[model samples]
Target: MLELSPILPIAWLLVSLGFLKMPAYKACLIGLAISGIEAISLWQMDYVLALKATLEGSVFALLPIIWVIVAAFFTYNISLHTGAITHIKQFMSSLSGDRRIQALLIAWGFGGFLEAVAGFGTAVAVPAALLIALGFEPFLAAVVCIFANTAAVAFGVVGIPVNTLAQITELPILPISMAIVWQLAPFGVLVPLLIVVTITKSLKGLQGVWLTTLISGISFGLAQFVVAKYVGPELPAIIGSIFAFLATVLSAKVSPPLRDWKFPREREAAASFAKVQA
Candidate 1:
């Protein structure tokens, strides 16, 4: 009796997350069921058209997503079998034992590199796996890698999003890339901040992490902005990540040590972390 928008969809989401204790995939199903019921009741006169809209979304979800998932699996399986990835970790750790640095290089740097080429779940999973193989805990690896890959997704695979948007909309790619950088810069910084917090278990790394995150984000965003603005859309993702990688590397080397490390006795959380580290 109530309007569907006013009552049902929100109910479905809440019930799924709250009552049924369902995860996201199943939550989607609950939302779909609610929508289907609404559509059938409201569109009784043109149920076919309503059904067509529903089917259209399923069709779109099926084609591109399945292809990307299948391709990522192939890359992951091969990389695992080849043992080349282990060496990649060994090479990484030899450079720095600080997990934060490793996260920046592998998850942020190398993950971004994969995004420049792969640009999907593959970019996230592959680098996440590399982080685990290199000695990070699983949750740490997963979060670090996933978040790192996302910063460049808007321009990834040689600026696919901007390129395609430009082509379809007939907008200039340069302005599009610049706008994307504005959106992406904060996300870029968030990537490093996430990794450090994931590993350090604090916002303690915040000061240095913020510094590194901004530098990397700015470098990559600027590189992509400039290149896409003047040159074209074809290489921004790869080039920008390369620039980010270099920027973070240089920052890690030059950052001053946290000369005033202390955990006040009253700060239980800080005290716990100190004990944990020791």
Candidate 2:
């Protein structure tokens, strides 16, 4: 059974996500039925204990997952019902005409702003869906939003993690911020580059203005260092990403005409362009 813990996860994945060919809801029901029946058959505990375990397991399973999904659908519904989503896309498209810029604005900047507020899956789903609505491919939008959310995860909720660390460690806020930057500065440097690499595939994404990304990373890294060094802990995330985003504008200004630039393969572009035309 000790060994089974990892194996059980594999079996669970196979049933829910693979061979069952069932939707998530149906898979969940099947899993619950299997667990309940197995518990009874194995006589793992007294009936009362089994009942308690079952209830506990269900609550553990549902609460956080349900909270995330409920919050996601709620934000999604707000976008649909209020039409904040429309204005949002207009806001994004107007920011940059390039599809890549649209991805960064909607997924990174806007997504970071939302994550700063909501701190949940809404950060990704809402922005990615917005990008998709604005004519970006779904997968591309998801990838960028995921990258954009990283910068904010550490300090969002008005710097929750720093606050918690300060409280527990009884250290001053600056040191905690310093410690965070120790790990976060590298993470910040990597994400923007990762977004480019993921979208275009290979180092090919770095083809145009690669130095600009490096310089932008330097700007962000310096901002984080300053926030960790002189500025208060509360400001590193918002300030760092803002500086980084602004620095990218330099790349837009300096890079060669994008049409002349090459990506991994021509066939892929033709297929993608065909889809866009369709």
Candidate 3:
């Protein structure tokens, strides 16, 4: 029972956030408070030391994590103000008429690029918003962006996360990155297909596009694996995303899908015209 004490606060946090649906900040603060109490009572930590540690952690969070998020948002806002985002949307839409392919390109490929350049939540936020602008349902867009962002997170922002892991674990960055690739690479391949499934709600949506999915996944996973194993962490996600994007685009050119699927509302006019002709 004593061993389980450490798990209580985390359980509380999950319940608060997942079940209660409390605001994350509030839930996190409550969890922190519980952790502090446990440290003082169970671990017999000095109050002053605990306070100092908390302050240091808060400073660290502000410096890199929060700072990166703010910078990313600011950059996104700049693009919005300059109307560059509109051009980006147009270019992405031109890549493939199929929403599934677009989701793979923007969420998997483009989101990975953003993750490589700027981690935090930037990769998810920017791509999700872009999908919404392209007429994706907001909830589905968010889900797709989040899933796409996961595989690249360990190497995000030039591999900051893996570097930090190496420092904390007193291990080599290359090995840690390589290990991460082993875990994430499979998921990288699956995310594009999963996003399409999530959107279409069936495996039938994968018709005529299995090759594109296979190439995208294999290229990304192989690039990530090779880069992490040989080149080091800083360039894996960047290189992987680039390779995946290129491979996917090339595959689409070689074998375009037989049909493009659109949202029901978007297809309403075309459906009506076909009905009239019939």
Candidate 4:
């Protein structure tokens, strides 16, 4: 029981957020209170030290994480106002009309790139928004984007996460980055396939585009591994995502889907048209 005391706050956070489906602010506040109580009672932490730690953490969140999110939103608004978002949607649509392919392209590939550059939920926010704009159901878009952000997260924001780990552990960044890449590379390959399955909600969804899915995954995983091994952590997500995007686009061109998969709205429209014709 004493040994497990350290994890109680985290467990409470997970339960509150995941099971209770509480608002993030409320969950975090409760979790913070729990942590403070545990520190004071279980760990015998001095009140002053606990207060200092909390202040430092709050400052860290405000300065780096919050600022990055603000900047990303600012950039997004600029892009939207300038009509760049519309052009991006058009360009992605031109790549492939299949919603499955589009999910892989936007959620996996583009989201990875955003994670590499901006991170701090920018990957999730930007990709999900693009997907919704492209006619994906909003909840599904959010879920797919969240899944797609996973593999790229280790090297996100120019490798801040890995660098921070290395700093804390007093280890060389390269070996740490390489090891992380090795571990995550397989998931990088698997996530695209998973995204497709999630979008289509059926095993049969993989039937036509399995090859393209494999191509996107393999290219992303391979490129991430190579870059992390040689070029260090900074470029893996960015370069790997670029490679995946290009590879997916080219392979899709070489072996295009026999019939482009339509979104639910498009399918409904087509059915209505058929009924009218009948």
Q: Pick the candidate with the highest TM-score.
A: 4
Task: Give candidate 4 misplaced runs (Cα > 4 Å).
Answer: 59-84, 163-173, 273-278
lDDT (10s digit) by residue, model 3, range 1-278: 45877998899988998899999899988888988898898888999999998899889888866776567557667878999878877787677888888888888899999989977677877787778777888789889989888877778689777788889999988788888899986797788788878888889888888789888888999998898999898999999999998998888878999888787788997889999999
- Candidate 4 lowest-lDDT run of ten: 68-77
Order the candidates by lDDT, highest first: 4, 3, 1, 2
**TM-score per candidate:** 0.70, 0.66, 0.80, 0.84
| Residues 1-278 of candidate 2: C-alpha lDDT, one tens digit per residue | 54454355447757676776778777766666666666666535477877798789778656754576566657766887988878876765444445554455456555665665666576787777776666657777777788878876777655777788789989899877887788877766687677667766678656654665565566766777897679766777667666666765555556532543333354588789999999
**Residue 254's lDDT in candidate 3:** 82
User: Candidate 1: where is the Cα deviation over 4 Å?
Assistant: 1-25, 38-85, 207-211, 253-278
After superposition, candidate 2 runs with Cα above 4 Å error:
1-22, 26-94, 254-257, 260-278
Q: Which consecutive 10 residues in model 2 have the weakest lDDT in total?
A: 256-265
Whole-structure CA lDDT of model 3: 0.85
The TM-score measured for candidate 4 stands at 0.84
Residue pairs with colliding backbones in model 1 are none
Residue clash pairs of candidate 2: none
TM-score of 2: 0.66
